[model samples]
Target: MSLPFKTLIKIERGNHLPMYVQIANELIKLIRGGKLTPGAFLPGTREMADLLAIHRKTIINAYEDLSVQGWIESLPRKGYRVVSDLPVIKPRSFQPKNNYPATSISPEELLHLPAFTRPGMVNDYQPGALIVDDGFPDINLTPYDFFLQQYRQQLNSGILYTLNFQKEEGGLLSLRTATSSFLNQTRGLNITHEQVAITRGAQMAIYLAAALLIKPGDRIIVSEPSYFMANQIFQQLGAVIHRVPVDEEGMDTNALEELLKTGTFKLIYVIPHHHHPTTVTMSTARRIQLLTLIKEYQLWAIEDDYDYDFHYRNSPILPLASADHDGRILYIGSYTKLLGPSFRIGYLVAGVQIIEQAIRYRRLMDIRGDFMMESALAALIDNGELSRHINRSKKIYAARLDKTTELLTSSNIPVSFHKPQGGMALWLRFDPQYPLANLLTNASANNLHLYGTAYFEGYNTNYNSLRFGFASLQEQQMEQAVSILAASLKKK
Candidate 1:
């Protein structure tokens, strides 16, 4: 039974396979080659670990694998012995030893793609860095444990039979129903589950709406200095985008009306509440005017209500989708921030016919969404747990927003910003005297992860502004960040 260590095995450290798996694989080869015959006793876990200079757990895992595969059996007091019987598994075709291309592309050819990349792609995560972001919620405040509990209870219950199959292309009926109820109460949209399609997130909902409403060469009106990602999406679809200047009132509905008179547009995309990147809510007058214009032109509108729940000041304005009686608006909202961005749960609200068409397009792109999580969200909504979480987090975020605003104002850095009525971020415009490069370099030197001004610099306009997100920062962090920003501004 004595075997030299070199003769018994050779371990390759550079291999991606875990040491335990490699050990099991080498042992399997020995067993198959009859070097270690059936009923031959093997070394104990401790003996193997010592010989290989690895943790005993590795050897134990290897033994467990061998036992599960019918390769070996453990005796009462003795070590593992090779099994007498084995299952027949046909050998797979031989794979070439040559290095394959990293991508699934031909060696001689190059694949060209549109130069489209995600907006605000983080190049690196610097530890202990304070980030001024484009309005994201504090996911750390999410009720993750409660949601996990519901998921676990459902998984352990008898309803597993129902959830195992594909439910509906529109998504879980329970979630759709729950979303309908929530929207009816909060956003003033009276809808049924049939009028909604659940998507991975609001981005997917935007994609679906665009795919359904827009054709190549179709004109779509959007706000200048609007969401970069939304413009990118429209560009990818070969749609011509017309930008209307946005001021304190939000997307010049007057300009939009003028554009409508001049030419036909397929659809209009608007962020009515806490308008993306700018953090400006559409004035009540503009809302009514925009609604009237859309109705008259029969132009479909995509209203992105991504951060509707985080209103801190006066009550939120009723969504345009709520007042659209002529089927002119498609409302898109996301629970991704409430549950964390990784939980890609969003809903699109439109006429039942439009929803049906969107479902078709959704099926072509993604076969279905996460049913189990959707169902869990439904349970949260039904019991009012989701509402309660929102109510609680809303207050905490409001305080954080106040603290961030206070810090920025006290910094005296010559930065001007409108005191936002609601939402998790402030739209800060620097004085033209301060160079953005100087500000960015100083911010980076102060350990603040400041993204460049690409987000504010849209196709038609370049505003010296940035969305200074507040929800994710604590009071101390906010103070530290503002102090650093002030210091950056003071330098030259």
Candidate 2:
């Protein structure tokens, strides 16, 4: 009897399982169900491939797997056939009862956790709409395929077993060592793998740094319009947040110095390069003065240089940690903005004592990062692949920023913005008379996505400004988006 190929075999492409594995498993089920009896011949690979609308290679691989498992045999001058003696396996007799156990914890009994408010940019996303992100990189420039190739090579070479199973909860030695060398060479920072704790991203680094440094009711200083996520982390740790004002030259060190003179603060958080939402680089004089204060007062600071690689106008100032001889700064950075957000590789550099404390806390939450990915990244860094990619991405992002500025200038919208010297976004301040909510709704209807005005909501006064990230948007898309924005303003 001939088998009905279409009715007997079905492959679900939407499933996480591979098509070939699904086919092989389905054939085993058919044999067990007595539909394919002992000594029955199977259909040809080509016929099955055509019937299923899949490639013949998939059928071949499935058949090979079945043959290896003794479910089928190949006869001379003939195709595959079901084996005479199918492996006898006892059927399961017990069924799991669906009743709830008395000891099981109910949802209502679970302890209440700390509450963190979701920001607008994190929640504002529409499918199939062109988005003006908040300082995100163009993911199209990421070399993921190359990284995948490196991963496969290491897996095949069987060298990842030892590389992954090391005792250090910090990170892979090779990656940390490579990162140390890279940071030292590029940013004028000196550090070793022992002083570096690899993290999933800058956010994780911030959380770890905050958790280790902050205690309940301890005062910590932050910029007024600081990175909101970092501020949230500090608040979650029960730290009293003292906000200072920022100017065109970056965080006002004068204000910080005055505060330190009369009062004591546990920690201060600063983003010196292309400050978030404002895109202002800190001046050299402020940096020197800030370092002097940190040393004199023995103050600890978290220096987050999230986008250190995309500078366009001139050479970026070295991080505060590079000049701190007294070890007062904990430097944090990530490759998410440089490579892609999906590549969650960030690092923290500090003194050995703090790194040891970070590692102890890190082990409780995460034993280690993805070693295979980290190893592959180290290989890329060693061979200069990451360097080349950064150089290429810098030029592309610079051009995109220039083009976006031109479009925004010509849009005739009631918005004023200064071209950012570095970083991926433009900070646009709308007239106080313009309605932000209406503008966002109208722009969404026009297929243009803009972040809601929730970023600067916690401030004393409502600052009518938004960071219009342009690195991810193409020239044509930028033009269309700005045009829609202008139309939305007119509609309002």
| Whole-model lDDT per candidate | 0.75, 0.77
Residue 43, model 1, lDDT = 89
What are the clashing pairs of model 2? none
Backbone clash total for model 2 is 0
**Superposing all C-alpha atoms, what RMSD in Å does each candidate have to the true structure?**
21.1, 19.6
User: Which 10 residues in a row give candidate 1 its minimum summed lDDT?
Assistant: 99-108
lDDT score, candidate 1: 0.75
| lDDT by residue for model 1 (1-492), tens | 555544577778885446776787788768766788777888888988888898999899989877765678899988898877542222111221111111111111111225643333456767887887666677787778767877787778867677777659899999999999988767766678888899999988988887777777989999887777778778877789998888888889888888899888888999978887778888888887887888788787889985888776766776777774366678899998676667899999887777877887787767889887888899778755576567667768878877777777777778888877778778888876675556776677677866523343445454667678788778888888888888777434
Per residue, candidate 2 scores C-alpha lDDT tens digits across 437-481 of 666667777777786223434567667678788898888888888
Give the distance in Å from residue 114's predicted Cα in candidate 2 to where it truly belongs.
Answer: 6.3
Looking at model 2, which ten-residue stretch has the lowest summed lDDT? 101-110
Q: How well does model 2 score by local distance difference test? A: 0.77
TM-score of each: 0.73, 0.74
